[model samples]
Target chain A: MSLSGLNSLYREVILDHSEHPHHKKNLKQATSKVTLKNPTCGDVINLELNLVDGKIADIGFTGEGCTISQSSASMMTDVVLGKTTEDGLEMAQIFSEMVMGQKRSAADLKKLGDAAILSSVMQFPARIKCATLCWWALRKSLGENVDD
Target chain B: MDSKFLKIRNDFPILNQKINNERLVYLDNAATSQKPQAVIDEIVRYYQNDNANTHRSVHTLGERATEEYEAARGKVQRFINAKESREIIFTQGTTDSLNLVASTYGEENISAGDEIVVSYMEHHSNLIPWQQLALRKHAILKYIELTNDGRLDMDDAQKKITDKTKVVAIAHVSNVLGVTNDIKKMAQIAHIHNAVMVIDGAQAVPNQPVDVQALDADFYAFSGHKMLGPMGIGVLYGKNNLLNKMSPYQYGGEMINFVEKYQSTWADIPWKFEAGTQNVAGAIGLGKAIDYLTEIGMQNIANYEQKLVEYALPKLLNIPEITVYGPHSPKLHNGVISFNLKGLHPHDLATALDMDGVAVRAGHHCAQPLMKYLNVVATARASFYIYNTVDDVDQLIYAIQDAKEFFKV
Candidate 1:
């Protein structure tokens, strides 16, 4: 066959983020620290957020998983860094919807930042759980149920 | 063996198809084996000729269904060398069969402070039911550790199974490690301790010849889908004496012989456990599958798989940056191998292999405790069967090399 589909899923940017993840250090003091794991695939994400004055001043994650899951966690931290807690939650919801084959407006898609590139991930049904694990961690740290 | 075992691959039409423009090298046999045309045809014939609820109706189709269903039970009994056909109880799959034993036999034998012994390598189906059973009955759950070579530690097993151990459940073969357990020795130990020995034979019955009476196991459970049969049909082979003493797992119409206002009598040893309407078509297909396996000869199938593992294991180990789990040779590990490439994750490696039309299982293989024991999160596994050839292993090696180059590892 062709490497086209595999290459699309494992984009260069995604690989770079997976290789050199941003804000992947442990936080000593944080507003909330939530650890979530994809029991199906064993992908784990320990997400810590500095929710200062209702805004996500800093966000970091530490875990081991596939490139898609790790890069998704990296990009999630990048997009939700300076956003409000509510906006971060909304961005996670939008990213989840986009990966689930939802058609989001460009304006709404912009809210997800680098996570929008995972739109091709919808074709790989098995990897969808990997892509959304970090987002589930984000929702959990914000006092929401992790399971959908 | 002759080329007949190889020619049997042609009987499975799905094996002739292509994936991603390449010939599909289906290697995930431990997860589920491909069904031959005979089994598929039997399922269709059941739907077309005999489609009726069994055991309750007097119609012609119902009689045919009941006959076919019981015939399938007899097939399973003969397949495993069980003394009585009534020892075979049909259920959903291996998981359901295991749960039946745990809920019924476990509830009757195990009391508070009693111990249930299982190994570290059990799949969740075999592990969780006992774990839940222990939790409910306030019993203790003990583990039989693995040896340094990844085989079951028989000395530890001897130590763990004591008078307090009311049940000893273990896998006949490791789904992840592919190492065969010493079930005969384990059963002897359980007998010395007066505990029932339950063998999770899901991975074993498909690849090797299993004689339950020879093994002296009290209960042997396996799934039909893993052995070229249709899904949703599984067999639970229990000793007649123990089955008579145990209670029924479910309360339903068919499993009852006589029902009063508040009391009920179970149908029989096997039927008492098989509650509700059973999967008649699945049972018929499983019987056909057993016929196919019998025609191939289980000894020949075992030898073919042994040759495949002998050819593949050394080649797999020769590859740099590849770490294979379980025993190094075919002497113990059999046809399954779990390994990890140096830099690539198993999920990504599996996807890359899929691009080459190679199907493999890339996860914990439903043994998270074993995953933790192996000190890795997950690994890619490619299991072989009678239909798989050495060429499939070469394809797997090439896929691993391609992944290493692609990921720049």
Candidate 2:
């Protein structure tokens, strides 16, 4: 692989999302909260979910991480906002499988919306955890047993 | 410039490989050094011939293995200028050696309200053991501050190590910053307070000459893999009186003198600490690594690495986007250089550099407290070794420049 291969991992969309992340804040009224750390690299994510009637009414995150993690978190929060807890959990699972290079139908991946762009993360095994860290935080906050 | 050190790279076969269609420039020596063929051959030669349980069976192979293992101990003793081979104990790595000291010596010595002082720049292997020991004993764990340039604050060390201080543990060299601490003076301070000084030489032993007696360190720990030997083998050097007094780190067959149902007597100092069957092949491999380093000479290695740093550091600092941690002057810095780009995280920088086949370490480097102290989550570190050449340093700079262009930062 040449340096040009980095283009697949750090596309313009990913760079834009990382540079100007959405929902990068703390929610004043968080129903459930979880903080996860990628211990190997010291990357941390504090995810706040304001769940109203089993739906993610609002979602926010605050932490320090690399570009992939930050952009992945941005994309994750964009897709999961206003999503039902069940749908959010399923989406997290799909995202995990997607980054791990597992097969997903177009219809199943379409549910991820813009977050599907992260399917390329499979090529960079080292950064797979960085991409999934925020999703793990989302799963744990939505009452899933994420043993991260 | 074709230097003799550049010629030394031929001894390491791994350095000849290519990554990402570019020459592999290994700058992760702080994490682990690549083994030379001599050490590799020594390990293979041992497994082929002297594969037997040491200090047991009276067979020829067992005796040969035992002699080789003990001879490795003698090499380690001379390598660090230890007074006796009995003071050296084989361990898994620097972490295991440190844990041994904490579990045995710290368990016996530390009590409530005593002070255990360490520096802010210590790696986790050196820090957590002492921190947990203090926690277990209800002792106060104090941190000696670093200067603005990232050097260990000697005044703060002097102030922190009072009469109540029972143990003073510090790294002989910072893995991230590459600044050598004043171990001799620090040991003097600890001795004045009647505290035992433990030196973590994991990074130091591989980079420069270390004399435990001259530094007056009561206990010193270092890993073999970081010094070009195999993993799962390390050395813990301690004073004879201290080793005799400390309890056995573990209980098992080799460390036993005689066992009777429930009661058991322990073996001598070194063997008492080395519980089960040891890493005999790894020990012999480390002996070979010591021999290789001895041939080149530690002072010569140190001097050559210093020249590389002097050449590389100014060029690295010239990049406006880079923020280097540690002393800015080449005279004060060693080979380990940690830095971060202006708009790029270290992880991103490391990945970008890897694309150019320059392997650097990017993380907290197991020095999370130091990272926190530096107010950054992580940083990219490029460390040098004997086989590293000036061309490798140029590749590192070019990669950084390429990363900057690729990221448009």
Candidate 3:
């Protein structure tokens, strides 16, 4: 059986990000920190955001998860490192919607950077949570009301 | 390969289809088995003709429904060799059955400082109910450790069950480890300590012949879905005397004999435990599944599965990157195989396998405590059943190889 279908889900960039995750460390002094877990698979993300003047000055995460989750977390930290908290939350919303198979504009998608590649995760419905877990952590750390 | 077992795949229409442009090789039977056409037909036929509330109305349909439902209980009783049909209480599933026992029997028996013994290998359904019960009563909860090879450490079991131990609950087969615990021996140990033995037969009953009476278990619980039956239907078998003494699990219609102004009397052992409208179709479907299993013969099925494990386990172990969690020898292992590839998370492996039409389970498997004990976050599991064949095993090996290559692990 050909596994060509997997090419869309596990792209080279995602694998590379998983192998060498950016900003995967414990921030010593952080204004906000949240730990989110995907109880279904025991994946945990401890996200720390150092917000100064309502902007994310530094962001880091430490967790154990699959390649998708690790890569997603890496990409998330890279994109939202210096963005304002409001923009970070907006990016989280866009990532969540994109992975849920929702349509998003190119400008909104551009804000996500490499994380937008996970839109293919909509096909693998089961792994959608793995891809969005870090974004949820970002939202929760930012004190946003994440009902979903 | 047995010719009879070879032909068993024909009975499941769902197994005949293609998945992901490849021949579907279902290896997730430990989660839930594929229902045979006979079982499906039974449910449809029940809904078409004999759909009614069981043990309630006086109409002919009600009588037929009640008869079929009770007959299903009898099938379960005979299937597990329970002493009587009254000992078989129809439940929502294994989780519901376990909770029923923990609520009724456990609640009535356990007290402060009492101890409940469970193993690290228990599924959450079996472990959490007792754990919660112990917490509610301020009792102590103890665990039986596993041997280095992933088998239950019977020596630890002996050490754990003491005079303070009120209940010794364990799984008949480990869902992740693929090792069958010696329930009979464990029951003997529990009885010696005067503690009740609750056997979680959710994994065992579907794959092997179970004789609850021979095991002398106080309570035996199993789900129907894992045995080629419908979901939302399960069995909880308690000894007649124990069941007679325990309080009713739920209070509702059909469970009460008479309701006085302030109090009420309960029905018989089985019916008293079964409250509200029952799943008549599910029960009838379970009875059909039992009939199918009986025709195939439980011993034959067990032997066939052992053969499959013997054929599959060695090849699985041959992969240098793969680390199997259970016993390496097929003699000690069963159909359920949990493994992980070095540097490749199970979720990625499972996803890659799915692309090849190889369905597997990846996660903590609802056994977080066990996952902790194994020192891993999660692992991918491939379980076998009657319809799975040598070709399916070959497909699994091929898919694992493909996954490793895809992930470069």
Tens-digit lDDT track of model 1 for B185-239: 8999999989999999999999889999999989999999999999888989999
Candidate 3: docking tier: high
By the lDDT metric, which is better: model 2 or model 3? 2
Poorly placed runs, candidate 3 (over 4 Å)? none
Q: What is the TM-score of chain A alone in each candidate?
A: 0.95, 0.97, 0.97
**Model 1: DockQ vs. true structure:** 0.67
Lowest-lDDT window of 10 residues in candidate 1 chain A? A1-10
Model 2 lDDT tens row, A1-148: 2579899999999999999999999999999889999999999999999999989999999999999999999999999999999999999989999999999999999999889999998998998999999999998998878787
Tens-digit lDDT track of model 3 for B20-93: 99999999999999999999999999999989887778999999988888888888889999878999998999
Residues B1-409 of candidate 2: C-alpha lDDT, one tens digit per residue: 3377879889999999998889999999999999999999999999998899999979999999999999999999999999999999999999999999999999999999999999999999999999999988999999999999999999889899999999999999999998999999999999999999999999999989999999999999999998899999999999999999988989988998999997999999899999898999999999999999998899998999999999999999999999999999999999999999999999999999999999999999999999989999999999999988889999999999999999999
What ordering of candidates by DockQ runs from best to worst? 3, 2, 1
Ten-residue stretch with the least lDDT total in model 1 chain B: B1-10
Q: Which 10-residue window of candidate 2 chain B scores lowest in summed lDDT?
A: B1-10
Which of candidates 1 and 3 is the stronger one according to lDDT?
3
Q: 2 or 3: which has the higher DockQ?
A: 3
User: What lDDT, from 0 to 1, does candidate 3 have?
Assistant: 0.93
**Interface RMSD (Å), each candidate?**
1.5, 1.9, 0.6
What is the C-alpha RMSD, rounded to one decimal, of candidate 3? 1.0
Off by over 4 Å in 1: A143-148
